[model samples]
Target: MARNLDIALLRTFATVADQGSMTRASDILHLTQGAISQQIARLEALVGTALLLRHPRGLRLTPAGERFLGRIRPLIITNDEIWSEIERGDVSGPVRLGLPFDLVDSCFAASLKSYCEAFPKVELTLVCAASPDLLDMVGRGHLDLAVIERAVDSEGGEVLAIDRLVWVGARAGQAHKRSPLPISLVGETCVFRPAVSEALAEEKLASRMVFETGGLDATRIIVKMDLAISAWLASTVPADFDIISEDAGLPPLPSFAITLHRANGARGAIFDELARQLRNAMARPRLAA
Candidate 1:
């Protein structure tokens, strides 16, 4: 008879490898450091070799440990995915989720659709706005949880994707050729507004804000019509849009973190599960890259 590997032990090892610290892995797995150490030891004993080594930095995986983790990582991911699907029906509740307008179509369509289908009883409330507005809405009790984009170094929130900000123009758009640089603005409180302005100022590029709109559709129409150029997270750019190339003399934009924030005192299975879906969705692209 063949010996079976312990999936739980493998999972612990994988998590510790990703986090680089036994203490950090414990926090994520909700196990004490002693428990984490013991589990690692048990796994090493079963494998008949030391798998982890401690250096000044953190836990470094031995060659054997690296090979083990690589082999079992796929198994761990698939196991979790299967469990998520099976448990979906058991999860049903209202979950208020906020997102920037740009993310709804490009990144989250599949994940949100899966969520709605799996948790049929979940009353999902989706609010679309600028990142700052989403945070404000959550604070004012208008929302339960929000996925907001922030400067990469900003504190707080669970960072989902560290997204690249880029200048976007309509395909074959003449807006970039316009003198004084016709820049388009989204919402009044757009978080990217300042970033865009600062980038242009640093480059000493002459620019003018042309059309202002609270509606995303209207802004897209203006942009698609080749009237004004805009900025968007690289991942969220529309299929018909073009990222204004560096040769166009456009200043390089800063990267931002796609972050998740739950309301203060927020605690429930629904909140957690919904947030899990968001995390899973955002992690896919990053993992692929």
Candidate 2:
């Protein structure tokens, strides 16, 4: 009889597919490129087909490989969901989580601390990235749970909290309103981008991006320079930037729905517990930006 494919191989394949590159996948899996390659080769041999196309930039799944991936991903996730359910009483072992950077500073940090204290035996792992990246990670079962901005909606995660998104910058006296209106932005997947674009359009303002970065630190510095403005969670305001009122001819910005997702099934109970804690935290009366 042919040997069954190992879970490790499935995990390696999923990581490579998500990253689109063996090198990057290796970095994430904490395995050598050769090891990742070996796992893929074994999987391909067992399945008797080419699973990935080697390219200078990254790997792309063949049609068959893509189909195979689609079928297998749910299996992996379901397995975790089952395990999580059984382990609820135990709630032990490592729990890997993904989170957006802005949220780390805003509220999740405290939540994480509480979770650790409550489940002292459960090891915690964290992955910090943008909302889109966090969503993708959670969907693949690489993360047990993720706190992402509102945009990443799919079958895997559940909504945790709802919050408004808004634009902010220096007060009129301090605002420079530079020509071309220097604008700063995170990557395209940032939930705030569309809101910012719409707000500018409503005001009939044409702005050019002077700085675009993945890091929020750069956003803070650029906006502080008074040469640019950006959109962020209303709760993420740093105290220096003043919220630009919607009636000030700026388009109405959308609110964000914070979502929590875990692999479906028994393993999802921890996510439920964590989600409960998070919603309770947000319910308290708080200042908006």
Top-lDDT candidate index: 1
At residue 235, give the lDDT of candidate 2.
86
Best by TM-score: 1
How would you encode candidate 1's per-residue C-alpha lDDT over 144-208 as one tens digit per residue?
A: 98999999766656656678999888998889888899988787788899899999999899999
Cα lDDT over the full model 2 = 0.70
RMSD (CA, Å), candidate 2 to true, equals 13.1
TM-score list, all predictions = 0.78, 0.61
Model 1, residue 267: what's the lDDT? 73
lDDT of each prediction vs. the true structure? 0.82, 0.70
Distance from true location, Cα of 65 in model 2, Å: 51
Residue 184 displacement (Å), model 2: 1.3
